[model samples]
Target: TVQALLRESDNYIPQVEKIKYEVGNGTFVDDGGIYIRWINDIVRYGMYASKTFQRRDILGVYSGLVTRQLTDLEYAWEFNYLVDVKDEEDKKIRVCIDAKHMGNYMRFANHRDTNQNGDQLYVVYNDLWHVLYIAQAEIKLHEQIFVNYGQGYWENKKKYDF
Candidate 1:
């Protein structure tokens, strides 16, 4: 049975916990809920759902400890993973996540429909001072999650074929 989450209005804020740990080579949130695999040669790391989540649900929170605060956006995109958000000092910041060696389940989310999964995951820089991943649509069990890859990723891509 589904449990109803009550809120005063659509803007109701829920308490979200931050869990930071290794994703691929370990378990997190649940007992190893997410896994990485591929049938053959693929684009790269793929994050699959081990559990189902309702639409507008809080899927996961990006709680990686290691972050980079770049003075400019030019060198920030050089890293493989990154998110632009406001830090504790109330300043615009870009978080460069090095998921190649260390990361969590949230890193598996694709950008610019790179995984051909559309936009299943959404990046929300919450007012509670954290970046959380919300479900863009109803996420079924065992399905792959995706987030809107920033504009820079779509500049060269032709059409929304992916």
Candidate 2:
């Protein structure tokens, strides 16, 4: 459904073309191992923003946590490091979007983790700006992690009613 909406959007062509060019030039990976490709393209083309950070690095951190590859000691160490590195003053990051103007179709959900913790996430159909912004912000925790891969985050075994 999201793919279909994207295909229907006039802006989708240029965005996809830019992604193809980037992948072809080796500036971006084409293997589809990470959803960051789609996110980055959204930010770069859809939002008209410059590349502010490396998506791959951020994803590596998420992979470590999600896969339980980080040992207790490692996790503690990283947690401390992150706390120390976090902004001490005015630690808010703001994202402003005119949804109506953008003409974006977005969806949200909630579900439960394997451990039964509640998580909430969102999705956008054809709106690269919203999709990528949410993804990047979630990856950095500048905003909450609202999406997991292509699926919505789960909370309490029940998906959020959109």
Candidate 3:
């Protein structure tokens, strides 16, 4: 009975192959054509592509639970996950995708100066902005996926003088 239950759960698992043609969330995909790998002593883990991706291919959505801005300085680096968006009144405000505890594979993407992929923030009908990572160039298999976390991210960490 336990094995049968597990087999049924597989049906709900996200798969990249079943993704829609549009550039939205990738079937809530995780562990698709990507994997988490050890980097080095400095950079702990990084996400790498397991298959070649053409330019502008939708990788997956940076899916997470949305919440208001977090002011905890201890976890300031997580601020990179926060996105600025306009509210219903058209006033700009910061919204955070609290992905630390719950999120898809996109959270493992590291920062790169010349990243092969870039993220596009899209606002759905719910007015929540979702971060969508797309291939900036033709990326071969095994290449690391990186996105520019923006200048503000580094500026917040004065020690990261780059």
What is the per-residue lDDT of model 1 for residues 55-138, given as tens digits with 9 covering 90 to 100?
A: 666666554444664343321232223334666897875556344444466766665544333342223224323445676667
Better of 2 and 3 by lDDT: 3
Model 1, which residues run further than 4 Å from truth? 1-14, 17-33, 69-98, 113-128, 154-162
In candidate 3, where is summed lDDT lowest over 10 consecutive residues?
73-82
Better of 1 and 3 by lDDT: 3
By summed lDDT, which 10 consecutive residues of candidate 2 come out lowest?
A: 74-83
**Candidate 2 residue lDDT tens string, 1-162:** 445544443443444456547857889653322221133322221111122223312221111122212333211112221122223485533222222222211211112133211121112334322122222332322211232312221222334332
**lDDT preference between candidates 1 and 2, better one:** 1
- Name every residue pair that clashes in candidate 1: 112-149
Candidate 2: C-alpha lDDT: 0.27
Q: Let me know the TM-score candidate 2 reaches against the reference structure.
A: 0.23
Clashing pairs in 3: none
